[model samples]
Target chain A: MTTLQAPDTPFLALDVDRVDANIARLRQHLDLLGTPLRLHVKTAKSVDVAARAFGGGTGPITVSTLAEAEYFADAGWTDILYAVGLDPHKLPRAQALVERGVDLTMLLDSITQADALVQHCRTHGVTIPALIEIDCDGHRGGIRPDSADLIPIGRRLADAGCLRGVLDHAGESYFATTADDQRAAAGVERVTVLDAADRLRQADFACPVVSVGSTPTAHATAELTGVTEVRAGNFVFFDLVMAGIGVCRVADLALSVVVTVIGHHGNEGIFTDGGWMATSRDRGTAQQAVDQGYGLVADIDGVLIPDLLMVGASQEHGVLSIRPGSSRRLPHLPIGTRLRILPNHACATAAQHSRYLVHHGGSTDVVSQWPRHNGW
Target chain B: MTTLQAPDTPFLALDVDRVDANIARLRQHLDLLGTPLRLHVKTAKSVDVAARAFGGGTGPITVSTLAEAEYFADAGWTDILYAVGLDPHKLPRAQALVERGVDLTMLLDSITQADALVQHCRTHGVTIPALIEIDCDGHRGGIRPDSADLIPIGRRLADAGCLRGVLDHAGESYFATTADDQRAAAGVERVTVLDAADRLRQADFACPVVSVGSTPTAHATAELTGVTEVRAGNFVFFDLVMAGIGVCRVADLALSVVVTVIGHHGNEGIFTDGGWMATSRDRGTAQQAVDQGYGLVADIDGVLIPDLLMVGASQEHGVLSIRPGSSRRLPHLPIGTRLRILPNHACATAAQHSRYLVHHGGSTDVVSQWPRHNGW
Candidate 1:
């Protein structure tokens, strides 16, 4: 068996057992609600992880980049929703995937994009499936469900025979400090997207799919009544941000950067080879009740070291120190001691790496090596 | 000629003219001091950029990862110094590079590492060149010049016939708020590394290379009398962080992310496909006097868009808005309008991409495609 110490430092390690548990929990929760889970592949970006996510079948998935759509399509997963607002220039690339028999879906909120996609489809003699995004909480891209342009945008795509549905992401749910806030956000997300879908239907536009999700909202939502599918990526590998928001426990975090101790400053902190480049600069937990500096520092066995946090990071070095006033002395770990750092955002941290060392059943032995795809 | 509109949105664009000028400025400065410039390839990681930095030769270079060492070595660049503290387990890989007629140098700052390297070389009967990292500004790694362990560590490597030099990076220089502060930090960095080198020589150890640099210090240092080489990386493509430190002007930054407008949120802001995934979560300019939100937004021609900043970002969307109280009206660019974002840190931002779309002489045309190597 390949041990944890086999690979070099500053590589990503996936706790396969934890990942399976997390996936099972989400699947069970959504399965009870009768909502299909369109797993966001943008987080793991690995065929191995996707295999586990979909139970070894070509399941519906959501992607942030067209590159991801191409990659997963090559891996035999055909149903894809490119979740990012569509760029007109990338229509050709998306159409190519559609021509290959993949049920590729594009997203957009503006009439400009609707018109452009319609033009591109007409010019290319191809009909592409698309989603009109709705702004649930004004977190990011999307037209408001009550906006006058919603029907027009939907009509444009419907006229082109390309309107597939309407989707919304409660991305602001990550900032929720209480469970009530998250649950409320999830409720609004569901109602907002459903309302947009209803408006499309009232306008003679068949809105078949009504999608809504964010990691926090996916778990916090009490009802998925009108939602056809939930698209949550970070839940596959819950991070510190998810834990901070009460969405998941720290123990549920499945991804971490395995690094090596390199040096220490007297009474200040210990340093590691894993910097922002490894752990990522996503300070998603900075505004939470308890700020996780860069990440929560864990021992080689994936156990959190009490009171320790990576407070600072450079390009290739991380400053691991005890939280101020917690202890007077720093951990006197000898150089070369390996540690794992739980990230603030799994998607951002996972994107920093090209592959993952998968550990099964909580063993130190790596059971598999999973390669991840990157770039747009 | 391939126009700027050819590539998909959210790809990095390198202004070759700006890159050449940035490199020339650093080269000219270092040339006057009669110190060789061992360019740090950790920033660009592209052979094309390295070629420009080395003036089309296999010149001495420094890398932050062994993977970079291997990639550049395969490209015919023999001299390399892996700048990060060495991991004992990676000795075999370093030795393999050494065996391949590549003068690959490793770095270490502790006695534990010194002993490990000596043991590894003794066991394999292969000599590996190494540098003793000195703590110049208490920013990151290295032992103090006057520390008792300094000479002992040098003697340990010297006894093994693997000691090559002493090096230090004044990373704290980045925190300097004024020109005088930066100059003073650079002065201290030079003296600290030189003192360690002198001490090693006094102990009968021939410390040949005394390398010192950080982009800020490299530009601010008024003298390099005893320094053998200046190792500066980000100077090849100055970033917002460097500009905030007064090392370079905004116009000198060569790298940018070309994105397309995807949506607008009333008068609050506009959104683009570029986000933390494209610009990187390097909030480097946040601490500066003028906080550049996520990054400074620019027009298609690379000219700074007045009063605008990428105020926020999600995974796949950047919220571009006019800074608060500035005109109160965001630019009315329709969806699909292309824009460029200047990153805060070149090293962190460039690491997000696999290739660069090179625009020579300020032309909108993409003249070349430069591939970059990532992952350790």
Candidate 2:
């Protein structure tokens, strides 16, 4: 009903054609290395996009929350790797997913988690598989590859018949300013997980799968070698952060926040009916060279409004202005003019909305609605 | 079920006792000024909170989205104000609310919106009321008190029988560093709205109601002379941003994010199951004197964990560590240990969750779960 009607402003607009192109680009790159994508469903949690990403079929995917695992499982996605380090308290839900005939794999970097997983499986009468996380660049969670606890943690999982493989995510690679930096980060990620797998294998464990990726690293990495699959979520709808890192061009961003210009603020800028609540407070590009405040602005039809940016935001109000130091004049966008804001981080921005108003090609009208799964 | 079972970490926890106290504090202040509070439900967008906010009865409420307006209206709350600057595309839903017998008042600062409202009502046969926004402190939206267009804007709405009053929000007051500063901001806010309302009245427009507030100004204003009603939202669940501004103490914060220690990140910090995806990427306090990174860290019992802070966040991982330059040792929070993170901004952080795990006075165990209405 919201789709058939004029969409309430500040809704997420997803360009499906751009989604197809992005998927194909990643697929072609990974195909050359004979590595399949275990697409992470964290960004576009909608089963609609998940099906599209796999060429209209469900496939192996990575999830960050059990809610995602359960949602995807209900939608017929059987293989899921919960890539965040396992929290022992979530065992009941994880076991429930396993009981649903899902190949739900959890990730852990500690012996404490391995022991807890072992205990939970034994008590719940369910075998929930797990992957050991390797810290490729210390961007976030993971066990250092050289850590003495690695073997003991893997041994704990192996003894419990829950060890699936080893995985790594190059979180730091997102800050890469060049393809070379991304490739190097990817190389480190690959080597780190493979090394951990080798150590586990030498310790009489069959570490079958080797998973490693991040949106930037995935596109930059040249070879997979012993890796069975790669995982990524934010690549499907490229954003300004990816654009800032030189991973994708602004033209390649498929997702945007559609907002209506409610009023003008003097002659310098205008206010939109969208703000942090709609676009999210993810200033992912602030750390990059060219800080895209909130996001870059575009027309409803997806054409970039040169040098215009959403510079500030409150809860439900966005302030759009010409980029500081730019010679471009502020566009005369009257009240009711719909503007599309390309987000700084696609995953963060996409999470703000519960559904996507699907767009095809360059038309401003939404073709359909796709519900997004949110919350853990 | 989520309440009885050990919770999946990274859920929003709301303290009912704190909520009652916060509500009482604001109500007591407003009562002294003989002004009724038009509670802004934008902060706590749950009907349960809305009910508690009005002492278990529906009263006047302000909403930023039609979703909240519709949701609140369904719960038997009659008086409502859609506070965001009116987007013409949203007239259909607004009309639908009015059709349902909800006294919905929209906001506007431009003649464009006034003319559009007049045309929409004439075409659709629906009478919708509106308030002229006065720009106080140049914070966000609203028309200037002395602007020549103000009289015309009021005239258009007056001719259409849609004029209700004038409103202003001292948004800049949320950053006040002292009580005097907040008081000064509040005085400016009250005077601005009253001046604009007076101008409209002198022009023969019946500007009956005067609404003005922001959490800080509502608490600090010395008088509400000529102000019919005051509006404020964030005081219900005061956050670190409010604390930094000296509006309230940290003990007044009613909301916290409950997360589990998934793993340790060496001796310096621990990783939490919660992150920006759970807490939201609202670094509101970053602009304050003491930036509370993602948020302050607390134990499951709601006790502060001494100088500990959720210093950094990824999509699904939060890094909890002792504050930099502090001598306090980072306490050991082993895997499976639960912790609660007080947020930087309640409105932004609470929006990330779809429900609240209700608790009473220092208790970690949730008493019940209340659903939150989301999206436009």
The CAPRI category of model 2 is high
Best by DockQ: 2
- Model 2 chain A poorest ten-residue lDDT run: A1-10
What local distance difference test score does each model get? 0.90, 0.90
What is the DockQ for all candidates, taken in turn?
0.80, 0.87
Tell me the spans in candidate 2 whose CA falls farther than 4 Å from its real position. Answer: A1-5, B1-5
The number of residue pairs in model 2 that clash at the backbone is: 0
In candidate 1, position B68 carries an lDDT of: 95
> Could you tell me which 10 consecutive residues in candidate 2 chain B have the lowest summed lDDT?
B1-10
| B299-356 per-residue lDDT for model 1 (tens digits) | 8898888988999988889999998777656778888899999999999999999999
**By DockQ thresholds, what CAPRI class is model 1?**
medium
Measured over the true interface residues after superposition, the C-alpha RMSD of each candidate is 1.0, 0.8
lDDT digits (tens) for residues A1-376 of candidate 2 = 3331267778899999999899999999999999999998999998999888887999999998889999999989898999999988888888888887998899999888999999998887789889999998888888888899999998888888999999999988988899999999999999999999899999999999899989999999998999999998788999999999888999999999999999988987799999999999999889989999999998887888999999999999999999999998889999998889999999999999999989886676678889999999
Model 1 lDDT per residue over A201-225, tens place = 8888898899999888888888999
